[model samples]
Target: MIIISTLVFFALLLIGLDVGFSMILAALIGMVLRSGAGIDPVMAPMTLVSSVDSVALITIPMFVLAGEIMNRGGVTRRLIDWSAAMVGHFRGSLSQVSIMTNFIMSGITGSAVADATATGSILIPEMKKEGYKPGYASAVVAAGSMLGPILPPSIPMILYAVMANLSVLRLFLAGVVPAILLCAGYMVICGIIARRRDYRAREKASWGTRIKVTRASIWALMMPLLIIGGIRSGLITDTEAAGMICVYALVIGLFVYRDLKYKDLGAVFYHAGRTSAVILFLLAAAGPFAWLLSESHIATAISQAILSISTDHFTVLVVVNLLLLAVGMILEPLPALVMFVPTLLPIQAQLGIDPIHFATVVIVNLMIGMLHPPVGLLVFVTSAIGRTPIWSVAVEVLPFLGWSIVVLILISAFPGLVVWLPNLVMK
Candidate 1:
């Protein structure tokens, strides 16, 4: 039954079915066959409702709405200007600017697709005009945009927390150091490339200009601090932080920036709703599929199989990373999270690995997958927005990919990188 269900799921995906629906169909078949009875209609709806009933889930849409408002509200322009002013005097200024902009935007949006779309639209063209190769420009955008999930207030971290029965706040904190490391790693690679390619730096900005740009972007920068600080200070729940950020973003967009008008709000809400719905649907479908695996003891079976191979924690960790890297290449992170995290949680316990560390590693792996070719969502997004060919963008992303893998290995080998911030803050 498991073999058949797995085949059906992949087959549906191959035929271009929506991931949410494909998961549901495959699960339904498995449930019916395993029960040796016709499908129990109550099971599907019950699973979905239970999966989404959590108050924690509300943050997903709130964060989505916040990102939408910020994007349309002219926040991206301010962020870009601020990043350029701060780093434009350095060699590879544009590349450095792209990385810094992604870091700031990651705090605001927490969605790599949104980040790639927003940043690529603005910076890719500018980079090309400034003599950067289109492929390299697009590659930088795609690679840096991945910071969205690795930074705090991330939707993927929230989902992983709920799935693993871990603390959302802790998971959010856990990502901080690793995210900073990745940003630094990207900047180092960018600097090297800049020197080799002789990319020119802009004249240093005057203090007057720097102050003006900083003043303009201060409010935009405050959004992440407010969310993270409020949560860490115990002044607000994660959901409340998300809601407050949404309201703040709306006000900044409609009144302060004046870029997002009342009329534009409808489209913003519509887009947020659409993106949120897809995620919720995927979560709902994943509930049943995950339940089936647990019910059939498939998760335990896999755990036992791994333990049989080797009991050494490092060996097991390495093996699991390889498996996740392969799975990430083919699957979107959300669905992949739903399908695999449950199965791996048992193995995680057997090895006594920290949940927060495992979650961080899983997210980093999946984010890297977003850069891989063929099905990499961000690859397509950057290519289309930058007007670069997918092949060229893929080729250009190779160096950034190598850098990301190095960070992944470092984080995995030293779990302290993923856990120290969480421990200090949460304790």
Candidate 2:
């Protein structure tokens, strides 16, 4: 049953069906085939309904809406200006700006694709004009955007929390150190490349200019801090925080920046609704698919198979990371998370791994996959935005990829990087 369902799922994917529907179809086939063996047909639809019926799930759409509003409301421009003022004096300044801006934007957007699109659109042309190679500009944007899913308010983290039965606040906290480490690593890589290539820095900005930029951008910057702080202080639930962010984004966009027009809001809502629908549908379909796996004991079988290969936790972790990396190269993060997290969650108990730490490892691996070759969504997005060839961007991203992998390995080896903040804060 497991083999056949797996084959059907891949086959549906090959034939161009939506991923959510493909998962649903595969699970339905499995359930029907096993109907006489204590698998009730009614279980499939019920699972789908129950999966998306969470109050916590409401946060996803609200966050998505806030991100969309910010994008259209000129928030990215303010972030770029602020980042440039802060980092533009460094050698390879534009590259540094790209990294820093993406880090800040990741806090607002929480979607890698949006980060790549927003930053790449603004900075890639500027970087090229300032003597940076197009491929390098695109590469920086793609690699830096990986921070989106690693930072707090992360959509992927929320999904992982829901699936793993972990606290959303704890998972969000778990990502902080790892996110900082990646940001620092990218900065180092940017500096190295800039020095080797003789990239020139912009003239140093005065304190007055820095202060002006900071003042202009502070409202844009406060969204993430407010959401995280509110949740951390137990002042609001994640869902409430998300709704507040939406309101905050609207007011800032309309009143403060005055870039968001009332009429344009219709389009923003349309886009947000569409994106939210895709995610919610994936979650709904993943329900029965995961349920079917659990019902058939396939999840346990896979976990035992890995344990038999090696009882060493480190060895199992390395193998799992490799598999997830390979999977991520081909699949987008959300669909991949829904399909694999259940299969792997059982291993946490067997290996004595903390769920939050395991989640960080898995998410980091998949986020890096966004920069990988062939089907990397961010790679394509950045390439198009920068007007660079995909191959060139692919080549340019390799060093950053290495840096990301180093961070991933460190996070895996030291679970404290992921667990320490959550443990301290949540306690």
Q: Identify the leading candidate in terms of lDDT.
A: 2
Report residue 85 deviation for candidate 2 (angstroms).
0.8
Per-model lDDT: 0.89, 0.90
lDDT by residue for model 2 over 1-427, one digit each (tens)? 8689989998999899989999999999999999989898798889999988888889999999999999999999998989889999988999999999999988898889888887888889988998898999999999889899899789999998887788998988888898889888888899999999999988888999999999999998988889888998989989999999999999999999999999999999999999899989998999999999899888898899888889787788888999999998778889888888999988987788888899989999888888888678888999999878999999999999998999889988888988999999888
lDDT of 1 by residue, 1-427 (tens): 8778889999999999988888888888888887765446458678878888888999999999999999999999999999999988888999999999999999999999999999999999999999999999999999999999988779899898888788888888888898898899889889989999999999999999999999999989998889889988899998999999999998999889899999998899999999999888889989778877877789999889888889787678878889888998789888898899988898889889988998899889888889887678888899999888999999988988888888889988999999999898878
Per-residue lDDT, model 2, residue 152, is 77
Candidate 1 versus the native: TM-score? 0.97
Error of 1 at 115 (Å): 0.4
All candidates: TM-score: 0.97, 0.97
What's the lDDT for residue 422 in model 2? 90
- The 10-residue segment with the lowest total lDDT in model 2: 368-377
Error of 2 at 271 (Å): 0.8
